[model samples]
Target: MNITVVGTGYVGLVTGIAFAEVGHEVICLDVDEIKVAKLRQGNTPIYEPGLESYLIRNIEANRLAFTTVPTQAFAEADVIFIAVGTPERKDGSADLSYIEAACRTVAEEIRHSTVVVIKSTVPVGTNECLETMMNTISLHSIHVVSVPEFLREGQALSDTFQADRIVIGAQDAHSSELVRSIYEPFERPIFLTDRRSAELIKYGANAFLATKISFINEIANLCDELGANVDDVASGMGMDQRIGRSFLRAGIGYGGSCFPKDTKALVQIAGDVTHDFKLLKSVIEVNNTQRHRLVAMAKAHFGSLIGLRVAVLGLSFKPNTDDMREAASLVIIDELLESGAHVVAYDPVAQSQAKRILSPTVEYANSVTEAIDQADACLLVTEWDEIVDTPVDVYCKLMKNPVLFDGRNCYSLDEVKQSTLTYYSIGRNDIIHAYT
Candidate 1:
């Protein structure tokens, strides 16, 4: 199949590369000249594990290519996928201007019988709107299909290859079969539905996962009050066959390219349709609260962060990726700075990008140890392995006061108890200095 993937962000790039890997000729189109240049040179514009190698290998095999021209790329493509970013608007709805623009470009460029698949997360009726728009604008008949992507950032490549299920929404059988053939290599259960359901599935899946994290965070808050551990509670609950554990871990909420924005957008869309999505609203509130929870924990330990040197262990939302769209660490860092605490932060892959957002305010460290050096206390934001495995004894020698705030609860309470340092963690009793 000759495929053209529009908007080469995380979803677009991964979808294109994966299809190419499965013996499809794919051309990834991006408006960003620099990003296209990088991809053309076999370099990934974003940080996704295993994506760079796959991109290089496919490009070498002449099965995959990157381009800035949408028309040329979409001209003879059998399936064109619009995978652009639908960023959240101020009112929480997804900004569909990018999607609209891409559609217009495709409508003007499409000259042959093509199935246009939407891989971007959009509102319920977006597919209908696009179909109308395409019909009105195009001379030749074109089929519009909604096929939302469900790939996570760090594990996008793996998720694409081993997707649990695939959903393709089309108005007719021909369109459905064409989309199915594009994804036949996955050999997963496919859901064939109307365009609206396919669009809703993407938002619904992310919103539900966000709700799960928020629910656990709320439970973790109660656990802190009731003298219980969320880990134990989550673990015990997860043992039930119906409640299989996936997003049960209590932490500083979810952040990245998907959850935060999608949850809010869904809530907004529901509101536009005169419906109340209270559950999603609560999920958004809980996620917001989780970000500030770490700051409150930090203040509880030091009483006052003024004139303190705080070390932040990780900067990205999660590990194995450098992309930090809505990272909780940024919120923690801001709170620390506002309290007049000098912040030193370290992440293996995110420092350069973090530097752009956190410039002149937070100090970037060379390593986890370097970030911890001379700090009054440490805050473990993202559970990056390097920070999680750092020995407590190392803190004994590095900092003015040996203290650790495990935001993600990466360290065990028993392990912290064995060290000379005091430890503060989420959903657990704070470990204080016994001999201080």
Candidate 2:
């Protein structure tokens, strides 16, 4: 199959590369000339695990290409995927302008009858609306299908190839089969539904996962007050077959591309129809408050953050990606800076990206050791492998005060019990250094 993927962001790039890996000829189109140029030269603009290697392999095999010329790419393709971003609006609704623009380009450039797949995460009924828009604009018969992507950022490649199931939402049998054929090589279970249900499934899935995160974080917060261990509580609860654990880890909150946007969009989607999603609303409130948990802990310990030297261990929302969209570290660091705390931050891959989003007042350190050097306290925001794997005693040895506030609960109580650092983590009893 000759496939043209519109937009070379995380979703588009991963989808295009995944298809090429499965022996399809794929061309990724983006408006950014510099990004397209970098991709064409075997460079990936985003930091996703195993993406650059797959991109280079497919490009070397001549199965994949990158381009800024959408007409050329769209005209010669059997399938065109609208994989652009649908960012959140101020009102919490999904901003579908990008999807609309991609559809307009497809309507204008498509030369033949093609299977147009809406792979971007869009609001319900968007695919049907897009189908109507395309038919009104173009003389060519186009089959529009809703095939929402379920790839996580850091593990996009693995998730794409190893997805538990694929959802194909199309009005016609031909469109369903065409979309199915694209993923048949992966041999995953395929669920066929109407366009609206498929769109709802994407948002619904994300909302549910966000609910789990918020639920667990609330439980963790309760545990913190009651002198209980959330790890043991989560483990006990997850042992039930009905509640299989995935997002049950007690952490500050979820901060990535999907959960924050999708949850808010889902709430807005309900509100548009006059249904007040009260539960999801509280979930959002809990998550917002959770980001400030670490900062609160720091303030409680020291009484004042004015003129304090604080070390932030990680910047990315989660590990293995440089994306800082909705990252907890950003919220925490901003709050710290506002409170007059001197912040030193470090991330293995996200330093440059973080620098762009974070305040210039933040001091970027080259490594974990450098970031924590002579700091009054250390705040672990993102649980990167480098930050998690560092020796627990290093904090005590380097920090002037040896106080540690762990937002992600990166270290175990057992590990901190052996160290002289005063450790405060979510859902765990504070481990105070006898000397401190």
Model 1 misplaced stretches (Cα beyond 4 Å): 430-436
Across 317-369, the per-residue lDDT of candidate 2 in tens digits comes to 88999989999998999999999999999999999998788899999899999
Worst 10 residues of 1 by lDDT: 427-436
In candidate 1, position 31 carries an lDDT of 90
lDDT of each: 0.87, 0.90
RMSD of each candidate relative to the true structure: 1.8, 1.6
Best by lDDT: 2
Candidate 1 lDDT tens digits, 1-436: 8999998888898999999999999998889999999899999888887888999999999999988887779877988999998998898888999999999989888887678999999999999899889878988787899998888878887788789899999999999998998889887888999998898999999998898899989988888777777888899888887877889998889999899999988888889989999988989988998899877877876789999999999999999899888999888998899998999999999998998898587888989899999899888898888888888889888998878877788877787788788777767644443111
Q: What lDDT score is found at residue 92 in candidate 1?
A: 83
Question: Pairs clashing in candidate 1?
Answer: none
lDDT of 2 at 225: 75
Q: Model 2: what TM-score? A: 0.98
